[model samples]
Target: MTAFDAAAEFDRQVRTLLDRGHPEAAGLTAAEFGALLAPLRETVTERGGAAVAVAPEEGRVPFVLVVTREVVPVERAVALTTLAGRTKPGVVDRHFADGDLIRFTPTKEVELPDAHAYVLFDVERGEEFCGAVPEDAMAAIADRGRTPLTIEEGIALVTQYPAALAKNKCFSLGGSRCGDRRVPAIWISQNAPKLGWCWAGNPHSWLGMASAAGRAAAGT
Candidate 1:
């Protein structure tokens, strides 16, 4: 779509948020709101996604949303939040790995099914998207007594029993820490073991493997 068309769509989304009683939008004048959407509009046009404005609660500043077709990495999400001038931008999805966002908020305020259980803000999209895990799946994982696998365990599992990774839907969350920096992690889904090759023998090791695993799960 043309930049102009994208901007119009963004404006429409913002208006919808306002109509939904977003307090942050209530505070901003139309021009100010437009200014906030400017960067996001350009981003969506260049990147081919949608943008929205999330109203802040309890006196927080409103954020510009930058929606993408795939799950955004934590580092990239942080960068997007920084670019948008928010200390903590929201990064929402159906499933999240540890470190996908620095913090997570569980809210029933979102529109997606089972999203009321938990949601992450997309710093780039500036709003929540329809990717949060459904409530049934969360319950199933719990019922199966499945806990997040440690980095070592994940590596061992993939290395020793590669096929089992996909069959058992075994995946790891965020446990790999790289020095002082925390790499943004992604959820490991049914196809995790196949992702090992992406980080196999890499210096970052676990973190790379987890990142690749998340991408594969998200099909990004």
Candidate 2:
């Protein structure tokens, strides 16, 4: 498939997984999952590779860890990785630095490689991913004179709420990245670095490796 076609497919899979509403719905967070595959697509485009995820009519992901430089066919790309997972770590790790952007709910979290192992985020310099949203004085969205938003809406609305926005979901999960007790960590882009959540679409599918309960709640 073409790069745009692949991205569209990836986006569809994420939406499908999110729509499942399964609590185990906990899979890779939207950013994590998106970051994981986008780069592969880029590389594929550069190399003219057609390798991409086969549309999953079912829940199970038939294609995982696609790596190719381009000019390669999807079938060939798929078969090549089966030879050895040597390139897997580089792609995965590059996107998951402890300080990299991530998302998590009560079920699970998508942590970057360089993040704080104990905190599930980064703790270097002043940047840290507490992995939870801080409890601010604002009650609920309704309390703030607004309606409760869907995950996608919330992601968008949070951007304007200085007190409510975050770089990481660590704060939402109930934790403090720093001792300041001031602000929760923000979720940064895994690849883009400083960019934060745009919520271009809904994150109903935002999840990664979830626990049984999380899956149930997320409707996975």
Candidate 3:
């Protein structure tokens, strides 16, 4: 199929899956996911699409998916911080890992499963995406007893989610310091920021305001 044909088929297939998953999806089945996304499969035959993750035993992710401007509906856990970037380019495997959170709000016609909900990010904030109870983002994770993602992995996961995040000017949400210095440095938007790519990684970290709030709430 042509690129347009492939894209259209992919969209149709995913929508069918979502529709089936929803009560309204009357005639959808998972068996056709491959047929729906058949065009992308050409990457393997022509463009050399393959696994390139950094390490076999690195983070929780086993592989990565790179869809440009395609908002795929993953479990809300997949979304980390607000507008986290995508995975690093040409790693052993990269999805949207730019050391940022993957932000989401409400966008239509993006990815499978449908709906937006702040998927992931490269930054560290309080309990924003994790909700009242911090749960793992990937729904495929059957093992709930696994150790919480390390800061590096957490950042990696959030960064994998595609969106836009800014990192130019520091967003100071005044609070404690990084250590025992009690420094007034918490990276949150000075103004009410919606869930989107607030900044791009320059100093390699987004100072999320939620971190301070979470710290204060924890009495740390």
TM-scores, one per candidate: 0.24, 0.19, 0.23
- Give me the displacement of residue 102 in model 2, in angstroms: 26
Q: What lDDT tens digits, residue by residue, belong to model 3 across residues 81-168?
A: 3343222221111322343222321112112221211111112332222222122221112132212222222222333422212343
Off by over 4 Å in 1: 1-5, 21-26, 48-220
Q: After superposition, how far is residue 107 of candidate 1 from its true place, in Å?
A: 14
Expressed as tens digits, the lDDT of each residue in 106-166 for candidate 1 is 1222122121111112111101111323233223333543222223323223222223222
The lowest-lDDT stretch of 10 consecutive residues in candidate 1 is 211-220
TM-score for candidate 3, please give it.
0.23
Q: lDDT at 179 for candidate 2?
A: 27
Whole-structure CA lDDT of model 1: 0.28
- Please list the C-alpha lDDT of all candidates, in the order they appear: 0.28, 0.23, 0.25
Q: Which is the winner by lDDT between candidate 1 and candidate 2?
A: 1
- Tell me the tens digit of each residue's lDDT in model 2 across 1-220: 6324544543453343333221122234655544534443343223222223333221122222211112222222222111011222101113224543223211113222211111010011111212212232112221333211112212211221222322332112122122223222123233211212222112212211100011000111
Q: What's the alpha carbon RMSD for model 1?
A: 18.4
Which one wins by TM-score: 1 or 2? 1
